[model samples]
Target: MRPVYAISGGVSKFAKSRPDKNYQALVKEAYDYAIKDLEISFPAFTEIVDGSVASYFSDHFSRQLMAAIMAQDYLGLCPKPSHRVEGGGATGGLCFQEAWKSIASGHMEVAAAYGFETMSHVETWKGNEFIALASDVSFDYPVGGFYSGYYAMMVTRHMKEYGTTVEDMAHVSVKNHINAFHNPYAQKRNRYTIQDVRDAPMVAWPLTRLDICVMSDGAAATILASEEGIEKLEKAGAKIPRPLVKVTGIGRGTDAMRMADRPHVDFETFIKDYATDQEKESQETMKYYQKLWDQGTRYPGVHSFRAGRTAGNMAYRHAGIHDPLDELDFVELHDAYTSSEIQTYEDLGLCRYGEGGPFAASGKAFLPGIDYGLKLPDKPVCPVNPSGGLIACGHPVGATGLMQAVFAIWQLQGSIEKHFNDDTLQVKDAQKGAIHSHAGTGTYVTVSILEKE
Candidate 1:
């Protein structure tokens, strides 16, 4: 909300595993990188907000509640106000929001938002159990409902209703993996094919191993400054950074905790009834589900679609963007799964409802050079997940949202030339971009618009 808040610098280190580095080490690394990148001294920041999760999984790790304080100590930022913020997967974005508020409220002149996670220390199933805690314990846990099941249900319903196919989902994986090839910080760099995705072992029916993002270890940091802080630095003979990206807009939303609480039609029953009676019962069934779909779009998310939609709308309004497909140059979506990315296309108003599958298959979401189809627009409608996204870029829970912000800042500042091609997916003189992030089951969602200034 702060008009004067601008991102001066950012850094990220995302990888499949960082066994040698603990949470504190990762945070220190990211903070050091951000300061070096901005060529600014540590004293420039008056406050710090650390976004992190599950650091106390083992006794060897930092205490659960002391991660932020520990990070501050590691970075030699003592005697300064440093607070920790967590919103499940949306932790980093929320941290950025709080830091922005601090600067805007005149509490701090310069602030830093940093996030990290070290999941490699635990086993895969153990990590899944920990993450599952984010969901409603009474309803979700009783029925063995985790993220995979939630997404599978949504994808299954989408398929039955909208005719989204397996190939369509596979295309999403292919596109993002190709994008990951260009990202040095990405965890999964292997180039993949549609067949490769299809052949991968199934995690949930209709969703395969390739469809899901891997648990990762990573950290990301961003430096923010108010107008006064910038002037102070300049007056102090410091080199003012050029082409900073301002936080133009931000939106947040939440929904019912239980998936069943949200409106949804019995897709299987609807299909069966339609086959049995095409005239009377089938028509009523279709209408009923249509109503459900309408409601779902407004409050969608057994997987957080509602939060994204609400947040995106607020952001679009604040940013004065009437048409997302035409106005925004790039998007960093919460692509914890390939299905989520496709679903986001519709939620973000990039395309008509139920057209997400075809949109991905059209190759318009990928860079210009990668050939999923030659019929793709010379430039994509909006380049989604250019930094490889959560799928290949690594989803380190707390760090993911900030990583997305870092990508947007670098892309807007024209500092990411080595990673991506200048001629391919790059929007010419790009001015604006949006970052979307969500917590468990869409309990929390945040969207932010960044503008080149």
Candidate 2:
């Protein structure tokens, strides 16, 4: 019932890695960009909400969430209310949720939420160990099982049941890489062919190096205000952007922390069973048709907890969207792997449960020749990852959630430049757009839908 609003949002360029800047410096750079990008002066907001997943990794009380504290210091609001939120990869989105609730409840009139993580500063061996440990201890970590292994199990199962092939998996990476080619902020812009993906070095069995999202350093921020606070800011010197991308809904859900702990009848099992069905259909259909629907088949044993779909579904419910496949316009989802994007299409109801691969090949998801132009079957299901996701944009765990929020807001505001447009292109503010995030290996999910007034 409480209406939440965003006045401005911004993000630092997403890179595969940045060794030049330390954690604090990286956050400072992102905060400055957010402030200037929004055209807000130093004295704009009175409260700050910060978050980070790796502050524990950075130093005692030094994760990325410290960005709020850092921003307050930079803004010289030394005594303003500021706090941290920690939800592993979902930290940023949760931070935005908390700030929105604060304003909606009349606790804070104006607030700023910012997040960033410099994962490159940490050693990969230690980081991998830590991430692996975040899963269930007795079942997942004792033997050194990690996300790669866990997802590999799922992929294998899917292949066994669905009869999907490795070629199907290759298409996922190829689709996302081609989309990323137009994004200047993307970490890796090199285009990949289906053959290239098929030939790429395998990371776990079916999944290849290109299938994974690159770990990197980056930050993002958003400023929010209640209607009354906006009036006051405008009365003073701040130039709050008109027509706020208001947060209409927020929803979150949690699954078994580790797949090994998941009940045999749980959603994880359901997805695997579904993948198996897909394989059977592909095998049966491939004999008669060149493509299952329009694409090749994939191999199973690569199941991933799609946090974005779960979160996005919740946000859609709160925002009153019952038919996401038809009603929504564009999306920014966590593409931790190429398969993630394809799976999310099914999970989010954008495509039939196992038809996601064919959906990608339909030339209907994205506008042809336009980079980042993923669409719905007809109009372009609100362009997907227009800014490039973790696959193209680097994955900075603690900062990912907030980065999603920032990117969604930017897309809605038309602040992001479309790479190619000979004609005067105008995207009317999206009536409904969603941000999806996941944390702890898809163990946690959060979705938020934003709309224009």
lDDT scores for all predictions?
A: 0.72, 0.63
Write one digit per residue (lDDT tens) for candidate 2, span 1-453.
Answer: 456688776666777566676655666566666666655565443333222112212332234434556655664556666677777666777777877887888877767777766666557766666667667888768887887766666667655544546666665566567666666656787777767876778888888888778777777777777788677666655665556778888877667676655443333344444332332345554342334323433322134344444565566667787777557667677777666666676666666555666665555455344543233244344456655577777777767777777766766666656322221122345566777776665677777888776
Candidate 2 lDDT score relative to the true structure: 0.63
Query: For residues 314-429, what per-residue lDDT tens digits would candidate 1 score against the true structure?
Result: 77777787777878888999888888888888777776556788988876677655654334533566788887788888888777888888888878877677334433445557
Off by over 4 Å in 1: 43-63, 236-238, 264-304, 371-379, 418-426
Root-mean-square deviation (CA) per prediction: 6.6, 6.4
Best by TM-score: 1
Clashes of 1: 0
User: Where does candidate 2 stray beyond 4 Å?
Assistant: 44-75, 163-165, 264-310, 371-379, 418-429
TM-score of each: 0.86, 0.81
